[model samples]
Target: MVTLKQIAEELGISITTVSKALKEYPDVSKKTRKLVRETASMLNYKPNSFAVNLRTRESKTIGLIIPVIVHHFFSSVIKGIIEQAEKKGYLVIILQSNESYELEKKQVDLLLSKRVDGILISLANGTADFKHLNDVIENETPLVMFDKIAKMVKCSKVIIDDRKASYKATQHLIDIGCKRIAHFRGPLLPQNSIDRFLGYKKALLDNGLEYDSSLVYICECGDMSFEEGKLNAQKLLKEHKDVDGIFINTDLVAIGAMTEFMKQGVRIPEDISIVGFSNWFMASVISPSLTTINQPGLEMGINAFKLLYKEIKKKKKNSDFSFKELVLDTDLVIRESTKN
Candidate 1:
């Protein structure tokens, strides 16, 4: 905890001289700057970020809120955000809402209280109200949403074409001769989930296949866990014996359903074909490898932070800027889970 006063006293210079020298101000001689920097380094002196922020009116930090932490896609997103933020000399403060609306609201409040320069968020599954989000805008903070987002909120967003991606997934199943295709959709609240479900249904009808409500399973808890997938698989088996294919919302859930089907003596692609979303790493290593939609999590993160950074700069300059909606692309990776 070395202080500027201590460094100044050691150098027998005024505190102002020491501060300016450390900052490499032109008013201080280059020799003095070099000496002050060397001495500061030797003393392991660290500048107080709070004091620097107060002087510049910028925290040099941003807040990031996500729905999950252990998820592969989200982890990749985090890495991209951190890498990009570091390049811009900014730090990220990450918080997980764990899919709870209340927690998401509170986390927003916490970041606002800290007076972060900007915020990037992927809304929680249970988030239906936008008051907390609107509060950030009302406070004139730069905000960007990625992945799961609310359309009515006036902010920049980074996301993929969920409906189009899901349509491709479901159409692939239909193309492979899956006449009776079922769906394991995410919770109803998130726009991505709703769009994905719509895509699945539209694909069925477009291909002259019947869309059955009974075949559509919902993850009521909104966690979209492996256990939920397994439970849905069990329910599907009991309720609809004719289903020959399924389009799952996530890779983990698809793997869980695959595991369940295998245990029940059902052969993948032979008895039933499956397609999942998100293209998680486990999708490739699993027993028949899963066919999935490749959501660009890393690219999403990079673009999200880039948008937030731009908005932050604009806000700082008091420049008028238009909100942007960036939709990244998605691809369907064909694997052994589906018929060739």
Candidate 2:
């Protein structure tokens, strides 16, 4: 209920000074800033974001759009984003696309209506059309895409080297004497999934192993779900009884396949080796620790915020900027899922 005016009156300073100090303006002395901060903290003063936006023309709020927040990868990324955004005195508003283009477009429109300073997004699986995203760019709203990104959008992007990671995973399976390797891929529209599939094929060709069409199954499921993975695995195993290895696009899917494989009395590693992407927490705790590619989710999130901050600052300066695509490296974590 306390206002900035009340704090100013108690400190015997002008409201302008109090406001400037709260915003950490360089003109305010460090001592004054410290006193203002301490008093604001003690009073539990919450600034009116709307009033601040009206005056400064900036909401100091960033919008984040993800396919699904429950996924461990995205959850870690959100944690990183929250940590970095808080340090910069910015807030984040998250929206889940739920792997639907209609829902994703609606979320984008809602965020823009709220006058968010910038947006960070990972495109949904079903999002083949990018008209909504293009609208954001045309409106001069800064955007940073992470993980699943659209190739047509000219903006900063944060992503792991999917091709290299997938290649390494498939090659590892080959080294462990796996000739018949099957790939459980996600929706083919996203560049990330396509890159992974390419890597899977490259590894087989490089190792003198024949690439079989029957071994690659495209999971058309909108979101990466365990149920879809189980069904895919069942179909693959049923069709190809000689399958010896598997490379899945996600840990969740790999876990599902593993569960199904065990249910059918098939042994893991001993009978068929498996490699998963996104080294999630549960991967290590399962009956047989999973071997996976560690996608740096937290680092990706932090880097995305830093890029968005840069764009926001540039916009304030009215400067011309070039787009950048940041590709983070991935690590192949070996565990009990594949032979050492």
The superposed Cα distance between candidate 2 and the true structure at residue 308, in angstroms, equals 0.3
Query: Which lDDT tens digits does candidate 2 get at residues 1-340?
Result: 8799989998999999999999999999999999999998899999987897898999999999999999899999999998999999999999999888899999999999998999999999889999999989998999999999998888899998899999999999999999899999988788889999999999999999999987998887667889977898899878998999999999999999999999998889888899999999999999788999999999999999999999999999999777889999999999998976
**How close is every model to the real structure, measured as TM-score?**
0.97, 0.88
Taking the tens digit of each residue's C-alpha lDDT, what string does model 1 give over 147-244? 99999999999999999999999999998999899999999899999999999999999988888898999998789899988899899889988889
Model 2 pairs whose backbones collide? none
Candidate 2's displacement at residue 164, Å, is 1.2
The lDDT, on a scale of 0 to 1, for candidate 2 is 0.92
Model 2 CA deviation exceeding 4 Å by range: 1-47
lDDT per prediction? 0.95, 0.92
- Flag regions of model 1 displaced more than 4 Å: 25-31
Model 1, residue pairs in steric clash = none
